[model samples]
Target: MLFLPAFLTLLGSVSAVDIWLNFQTTNCRGSGSVLCPGLEPNTCCSVPGRTGNPYTSVTVMHIPSVWNLDCRGHAGNYCGPIRELQTSNGRNTVCLGRGPFGGGGYGFWNGRVAATAESAAEGNCTRPSIVSLGDGTQYDVADLNDDDFNEMILLLTSSFHSFDIVEADGISDDVPEKFNINKLDEASLLPRYY
Candidate 1:
C-alpha cells in the first residue's frame, strides 16, 4: 500500500544511529580479524602506528547512540563503513573500525577533570573517571558497556561508518590478568571479522 512507503521511511530515520566514539583495538582488528582488503597475510597495509603491527593499526569504534552523534565526522580515510552487528539475548551494541592514524582526533578529549593529570601519568588509567587532554578536550574513561575494565571512550566528531548494537572489548587489557584476549571476546563485542 502507499502507506508502506511512509512507514518504511519513518523506520529508517528512527533507526539511524549517530556514532561518536572510537576505541582502538589491537592490530589486524580493522580488517575484522580476517584480512585487510587486497592485503597479503601478515603484511601491514593499515594507516596507523606500525603498519606491520596488526594489533596496533585497528580501532574498535563504539556507537552508543546516546549522544545522537556516536560516530559521524571523519571517515578515517581507510576505515570501513559502519555496519550493524548481530547480538542475542538482551545485549545491545554497535561498532565500526578506523583503519589507522590520527589517533588524537578532534572532539572532546581531556579538557578538565580531576583524574586528567593522573591519567596522563598512568597512561592506561585505573579508575572510573575522565581524562582532560587540555585544550577543551575531554575523554570519558568508563566501562562503555563492555566488559573491558579499561575502556576509553573517545568522543569523535563523527564516524565514517557505522554498525548496529553489538559488543566490543579486548585491548589486550580489558580483563583481569588471569584471562586472555580470547576470554575477553566472550564478554565483549567481537570484531565481526576479527
Candidate 2:
C-alpha cells in the first residue's frame, strides 16, 4: 500500500509542468523569476505576485513531454482574452509581446498577462497549422490554436476574425509551405511579427 501511494505521487509529478516567467528578454535572462510549477493540463492558474507586472520572456519545462501555454491578460483567470500562446518544444525562451502584429512587435507583455493555461502535447509532435484571421486590413496568422486540433495553429485575425478546421484528403500544391519558428536560427531569439 505504501509503495502504491509513492508510485502514484511520482507519476503525478512526472506529468506536471514548470514554467518560468522573466522580466528581461533574450533567453529569459534577468531578475524577478517567477516559477509556476505543477501546472495541470487545460487548467488556468494565476501567477502569484506577477499580475500587473511587466514580464518580457518565458520558459516552460515539462518532464517527458511538451506542452502549449496560453497567457491571458486583464485578470488571473482564463475568461480574459488570450494574449499569447507559446510552445515548450522550441526555443526554450519565448519573448512576450503586447499584442498581435503592429501592436508592440515583441519583447514586452507589460503587465498585460495575469494568468496562464497549459495544454500538454501528445507525443513529441509540434503544431504546424497557421491560418490568417483578418477582417480586411491586415492578413497575419500569428495566433495559436483558436480551434483545438490536438496541436496549436497560428491564427491571425483582423477586424472580423473566425476560423475552422476540416480533414482534407490530400495536400494542395498551391498551399504555401508551413513555417516553423522553432527551425529559425539560434541567433534569432525574438519572435518576428509581420
What digit string (tens of lDDT, one per residue) describes model 2 on residues 16-120? 444443332335443223334554433333331222433444444443433223333212221123455554343333444432211110111223233212221
User: Residue 122 in model 1: shift from native, Å?
Assistant: 43
After superposing candidate 2 on the true structure, give the runs of residues whose Cα lies further than 4 Å from its correct spot.
1-13, 45-53, 63-79, 89-194
TM-score each candidate.
Answer: 0.22, 0.33
lDDT of 1 by residue, 106-160 (tens): 1112233223222222222122222221122232333234433222221111121
Q: Which parts of model 1 have CA positions greater than 4 angstroms off? A: 14-16, 21-23, 26-91, 97-194
Model 2 earns a TM-score of 0.33
Model 2 local distance difference test score: 0.30
Per-model C-alpha lDDT, please? 0.25, 0.30
What's the CA RMSD of model 2 in angstroms?
17.4
Model 1 has an lDDT value of: 0.25
